[model samples]
Target: STYRLLSLVLVEGARVQPHYIADTSRRSTLLELRTMHHIRQAVAALSPEGAARIAPTRIVSVHDIAPAPEITARRNRLTRRAYLGGQYDWLARFAAQFDIPALELCIHVDDKAHAFISEHVEQVEGEYWQLRKELVDTDLSLFRYFRFPVLHLTKLEMDRLARQHGFHEIMQKTWFCHSPWRGRPCGICNPCVYTAEEGMAHRLRPLARLSYTLLPVLSVVREARRFVRRVVKR
Candidate 1:
């Protein structure tokens, strides 16, 4: 959804200094890379002649860098504080270097569609709109280049926008899995779950769809395990 929005932003005369941040913690796979390429191609196909001015995407790896302890401590409830902090820090520096005034993020407060989900909360809580806004406004305040084009729209709204703009096919090709098992989406992962719940289960493969069907039972088992742990502690 975000990718399609970004592509539209570029098509509508938003100059893009393309960069892809590869976070090791997320375990992005070859499938994602291929889909990304296709998205780029789709964008290029829409560009007017000689207007394919979008730069080649520069892949920036955050595998070796530890998230700053201060940043992590501030957002202890959120699992990817360090990763998010680190990405913003690097982006700020990069923007400064190139004199880029705006960095557009496809964050939708309505759907809490920022990349990171919290370990301490249920999926809905993890995507709590206000909580995500606070994280962006507080911890990620290092740069003034932040611009959110779709901040007020929900995921479903974004889909509607894509479909209205005739990019629904490309939207279907976009990748969302944070973890891939054997080159397929790990159906129980947060991204997969969100995708399914958001009415994009058709995006998942047959095997993933099967796994998604078991999600409710899996949730029950997880809660039972947590309950047993709490009882043991008591």
Candidate 2:
């Protein structure tokens, strides 16, 4: 029922903004609706016990929740406006739909801090550190309305969190093996690097294998671009 409702809303949203929906690599709103319908049908075919065991007791939607208003009103806020807007809608709908409480899982990785190699590095000097610090200090109100737990998880902790969210490491490994570079998972991007590192640490060998194979390909493409630029100058 939740899936059906969400599909209807997504379809409506897409109808309202077809061009905006069409521009992204994510499934077209129509396709998403179809996919959800297919999933629901498959689940419905399962035995009651099987369905109950597999189905989430509480519907969970993980998002990057925004900081509190006090934090957002201040200077150097890292949370974007869209983050806040999405949180509002997600929370409102979640409250309305579920008879039992829904869990608004907010996952925050300290991206700016993660970007810095070391404190002494010029790339992450005073301003960068200060900005990251401000972001870290900001109050995130994820716990206010739902069962929110702040996890300052390292790469390893993130894997544990994923498992807690019903994704087994083996399943995750299989997913990475099959569709390793889908969408923005550019094999050379920071996210790819981090994912690779985490998977290896957790002994998700398949994910590590995919990352190793693709990262070199991405690096070669990047180098080829640099070479092309240099040649074009002549």
Candidate 3:
């Protein structure tokens, strides 16, 4: 039950391009994909047919959708609400491309992140919570298969469930760093910092991870690297 639907999404956008079409021929092959196996395991529970074809999601980027070209573009940062909008747009495109009869968009943002979403509107400068409840309430028709079934669980609890599904070893193999050092988790980015905070990566040091989360300069550099990687195919 614990492993029912935990939310820890660190899938490589490149892997599920439908073009790659995973050759899940053996366990060792799946292990090479690291954390994606956890997702595959979950999808298997929902619909075995969908799980079999994991390579259909390409060009997946998290952002906002604005009327202006600049705001909608990846160059500008999206407001929390716009970010959700962009996600919806992406799914629409995904379904169109893959000819998917239907798709289930599972959103399991962490408790730490959820602490920021609020519909009441924040006049404060430094706020982190605000879900675009108003927008979602209006045009419900846009989301044909968007499902956030596990907002009740925290990142820690969800991750624990992930490991519970006989994926403890593979979970460790999962990569989160956008700018991995020689193809390994930088272990200092925001996600990696959370990973350490939740006691997910024992190999990462306590002080270093905390320091990385606090340093704005390092955050920018890492985010830039991720942005570049997402736009350009290397």
Candidate 3 segments whose C-alpha is farther than 4 A from its true place = 1-102, 109-145, 197-234
Tens-digit lDDT track for model 3 on 29-86? 3333544556567666755554554553333222321233322342123234443434
| Candidate 1 local lDDT, residue 137 | 51
Whole-model lDDT for model 1 versus the true structure?
0.59
Across residues 84-185, which tens digit of lDDT does each residue of candidate 1 receive?
433445554454455555455555543432554322112233322223344445544342344555545667777787777666666776788878877778
For this target, which candidate reaches the highest lDDT against the unseen true structure? 1
Q: Note the Cα lDDT for every prediction shown.
A: 0.59, 0.35, 0.44
Rank order (by TM-score, best first): 1, 3, 2
For model 1, give the RMSD to the true fold: 7.7
Question: Relative to the unseen true structure, what is the C-alpha lDDT of residue 172 in candidate 2, on a scale of 0 to 100?
Answer: 35
- What candidate 2 gets wrong by more than 4 Å, as runs, is 1-23, 27-105, 108-148, 158-191, 200-217
